[model samples]
Target: MEEQRALRPPWALVRGAGDGSGWPWRSTLLLTVFVQVGSHFAAHGQEGGRAGLDAFARVLLVLACGQLLWRLRRPVPVVFGTAGVTALYLGAGYPYGPVFLAVAVACFSAVVAGHRRAAWAAVGLLWAVHLLVAHWLYRWLPPSGDSAASWGQEAVIAAWVAAIVALAELARVRREQWERERAERAEAARRRADEERLRIARELHDVLAHSISVIHVQAGVGLALLDSDPEQARTALTTIKSASKEALGEVRQVLDTLRTPGDAPRAPAPGLDRLPELVEQAASAGLTVHLEGEAPRLPPGADLAAFRIVQEALTNVVRHSGSRHARVRLDPGDRTSLRLCIDDDGPATGADAGGGGNGLAGMRERAAALGGTIEAGPRPDGGFRVLAVLPLRGEEEVDR
Candidate 1:
């Protein structure tokens, strides 16, 4: 795991740090003007440089001072140009003051532009040039115990400019670290939100789907048997009462899943153990369903998946295809997969709102949740088929 860096100060987080319009250039401009003027003082302050600059040296300073305002917009070019002019001034026996200012500004611009390596390269070059100018041209060194204040001044200015550049580099690094951490935290939050939404969608599918399908089938049963078998009709009425209560409990449980745990106990949901009830309910609704194979009770996730797929597929058979007969086949497919094939000998009449429906799509979604897949289309014998293969991580504890 990557450790997050401490957040940078607010002044750093505020964007637009180095735009041409930002304070960087404006501050650079002020410092540059001060440096250009100070160059003249430094030259005069030195031993035998000239009482004041020659006419041409003054002109170079004038031009460099003007160009310094756009340093952030064009850092590298400005530095190279200033360096060339400074070399020319040195060769002409002029002062190094304005040239040093230009080099410092150039380094600042590169760092602000996110050219960290380039910035360091510029720093090295500036230090090298300053040392060469001091040794070969000015015959200068830092003031030893031997009284040379001019030598000490040169050393002081060099240290000051280096410190400023170091601070700028620190600011750049801190800013980059801050941005990376902020982005990671936001991505984590987004992933968690997505997980919560998926869990809600699953609960909604399980509770609403199972309860509504149960209610619809039971209501159909009571109505169909009302004119035929009064005893069975009364039993269906009792079943409807039971289903409605179960639906209420399921709905309450689903709503409770949204609440904090200390609120209440959830009504435990049904699994494949309720397959007989589902089969009986389908029979009561006038469809003949045959169950085979001793199925092992599966993991809660796989069991819920099996139940939902069967429920959705059967609802689709009744609602979409004109199928009076449907066969459900569930057999263990080796050690890791359970295969479910529901074949309905019903003609596709192209009924129920011309094909876009919830039944098939819901089945597919449920299968996908368990890393399984479903395929539904016309079978070879001119009937519809719903085939699904679900993969499980563990074997069920019981066989029934």
Candidate 2:
């Protein structure tokens, strides 16, 4: 069968037989030929003692091999069918040859298809019947002069069946393991995609929220003062233009990362180096921000996280607080961490600006990603404050 399979055209061999079921038509046909031809030779050795290859024995052989055609699909039925047909052939005292190959192939298919009990039952039934025929029923079976077979031969047959089942079980286990690994890898990829989407969402929210708040305030200021003060209104218009343009550039930068992921950023990510820009944008929004303490140096991730936390906090104040005065205090703590505080002296405007928004959530996500913490709430002294503490080290180093 193997040789005949190798002789076929490579494409035909790969495509296999009928309906793309991978049915081994060529192999089964070759096996039938081998069994018949092999039985002819085996008959010569058992001449005059065992029954020669006759019409009935040939029918049995063909029946056994034909059942194998359905082995890959209906393995349970095929195994039983082949086992019964092979038992009939043996009981007729036909010459032993490759006729058993059909049963072995069927058993293997059944076992590997996860029908172990069916395969075992078929094998056991075949063995039990063979035992009854070779010992107790030999006097009434074919080849009249034959004696009962030795127990030693039955032991050999039992071992051969054990080997076939064992090999098939091993193959089944390996296939299951490969399938599980592939599923786990697919699940991991989906998780990473979800995380990337969330990170992008947070980035867009931070950029748009801060810039739009500045524009909203400046637009309101320019309208109120337009008739009374042309110069201040014009200044407010200029601030709006600057804030909108910077927002577009940063937004474009964030989008570029999505288009060409894993590539280096075209512009640097926003960091504490951009803190002055945040303060300036806030001032343009009619919120006077007082800065305190020199900024601490930090790894890029922590720096970006710090900046976004401050940005979102200020945006929240602009939209929700009635206070015109805000304070930003930086604390470089212990050479290992950097602390940030954004405070607005309030009576809040009674606006739930970020209650339905991602602003505060995004801020917390950023700080947590850096092994840091964020605290934001109404202060005891009538104000709102957002406090963040981020590790000064790289995220990978912190993970270790």
Candidate 3:
């Protein structure tokens, strides 16, 4: 289920209401009008000998209620100040009616802003003051003829305070849970982005590395036969042109996938079905590529990885092994695995073979990512060989 944030007052903004700029001036104005009405009611509620707040005391009451404008941003301080001023108004023997509303609101704001400890402390202090005032009214002031009525008023006040604290605490817990859920979602997105980047890098390497290697060899062949054998040189030139054009087209396709909308049609990913074209390209590069055994149907990921592995191995043969002849063997091992091996005769002039480049490392990573393995090195029989084995079962596990 999707987690939802706690509901808050219209004036409340930002977690803990710490952003001063989001304070609601209009809402404060409305609250001020309400408190003013409450103050007037308190003034008119004066009993027999009890007196209402004088001008200075009435001003203090208005100021106490106005302080709620900052309660969300500064809950603890607002609660303390409101409570202190309300206590003074009551202690001055002024008539009591709605003056305690300001203190109650401040305490609720503190709890909603995640200041539970301070809110509870304010509640305790306010309760103590209420007790003291009740005792004073009972002992010093003449009773209003009904002692039960006085007790009932005190009970009602206590109930209101408890309700405010309970509701505010519930809101605070929900807000905190929502924040944690949002953070987790963001982290998951970051991880998926990183994985996508790695996948694109691997695809680009596979597409360009083999194509560039073929073009390199054909270019060399064209240069050598340019003067001596014009016809052969022309053929080599054609091969280079075709190889480069195909590489450019494939690279553009890969890039276009990034910009394409989800519903747009896209070309299928390269797989073992394209191995024949790869072999023909290698042969045009002056490498005699002999193939044996057809590839069986495989999972899309495994098919692509297998094709890239063979392409990289042959490219290495043309560029590093210095061999004119190479052999590719495919073994469809049972229903769960496929094996591939590519080997080339030793260098034409007995030169030391160059070490594996990024092509080899990329091939290894592709194999490993598919729960497969690749081994490439000089064979004991004076040739370079690459062997790869890919598992077909559980492709979904590898893809994720």
Candidate 4:
């Protein structure tokens, strides 16, 4: 029992009745002691009765009430023990007192601990015993001819039992409701964790795929031109060096965001302001990219999404398209929307056209997340084209 008490959580004692600590047990024990000692004094001439309770009677009263200390953990057993002791006290013709209060408290603990039917059964048994004892007292002792007083006492006992049972049932209902709400909150937290993990996975995939593709192409070009064109070969080597460094920085940023505890410093996400750098890298990889209109003002999230979409599109051009030149156009579609278009000539023979992969799926997910739409397919002009229409209003609303 001591080991079990030590293993119990402090919160269980506070929130429920089963743990053997807190105000419930302390108050019960204090009330029992006070009532027992007060009754012993009342039985003396202080209450107009010269027949005082003997030492043995006082000891039995104390033992009966003390049994309630374990009421929360073994409520039913405590109820039976207290009831038996009270029967012995009453049979021995002792003074009537608060010794039976322990039985009521034990019954209440049983109900709060989710043994309603059993608690009701215990109450019935106690009521029967009380009636039988009252009958025995009426027969063995001389009647004072006061029938009203006897009936009144029985009514009071019945009322007390009803009140204790009602309060215990109410407490049980309230505790069940609390447990349900706690479960719902735990489920909501789990769903949020799942969503965050998926978002981080998408970010890592886009950043790594684009940067690594650029480095792979630049490395091949540097090796192929090392002997024939030393000057261009050196430029390819320079692009590879720069791309590798940037890739490492971005990868580190993503990892830090995931692993850091709280409020750690992080690099800012890429946006349209980095388009010029992207164009330069594409040029070094043997693709000429022509930039058009300026980017309109966008929310932070929309700006990052727009930059990734354009980056992925251009990366596909450098890897698959045989065309030396590609065109990128950005325009304000309306007061609340922006348009982006990228077109490149058909790929070289046997070069893999960007058809199906996580890249396209990731691009679509980003566009949809911001309430935008993207369309990509072969153009009538024998080239591949990607057109995206993104809403600025949704982003603005989210910012607000």
What are the clashing pairs of model 2? Answer: none
What TM-score would each prediction reach against the true structure?
A: 0.57, 0.85, 0.76, 0.74
Model 2's alpha-carbon lDDT is 0.84
lDDT, model 2, position 84: 92
Tens digits of per-residue lDDT, candidate 3, 249-356, equal 878877886787353426687888888888899889778888988898888778878988888788777777777899999998785778899988876343222323
Flag regions of model 4 displaced more than 4 Å.
Answer: 1-35, 38-105, 131-155, 259-266, 317-327, 341-356, 371-389, 393-400
Check candidate 3 and list the clashing pairs. Answer: none
Ranking by lDDT: 2, 3, 4, 1
Better of 2 and 4 by lDDT: 2
* Per-candidate alpha-carbon RMSD to the true structure: 9.0, 5.1, 5.1, 5.5
Candidate 1 wrong stretches, greater than 4 Å: 1-178, 217-236, 261-269, 349-356, 394-400
Candidate 2 or 1, higher TM-score: 2
Give the least accurate 10-residue stretch of model 3, judged by summed lDDT.
1-10
lDDT scores for all predictions?
0.65, 0.84, 0.75, 0.74
The local lDDT score (0 to 100) that residue 117 gets in candidate 3 is 90
In candidate 3 the C-alpha lDDT for residue 323 amounts to 73
Candidates sorted by TM-score, descending order?
2, 3, 4, 1
Worst 10-residue lDDT window for candidate 1 reads 140-149
TM-score of 2: 0.85
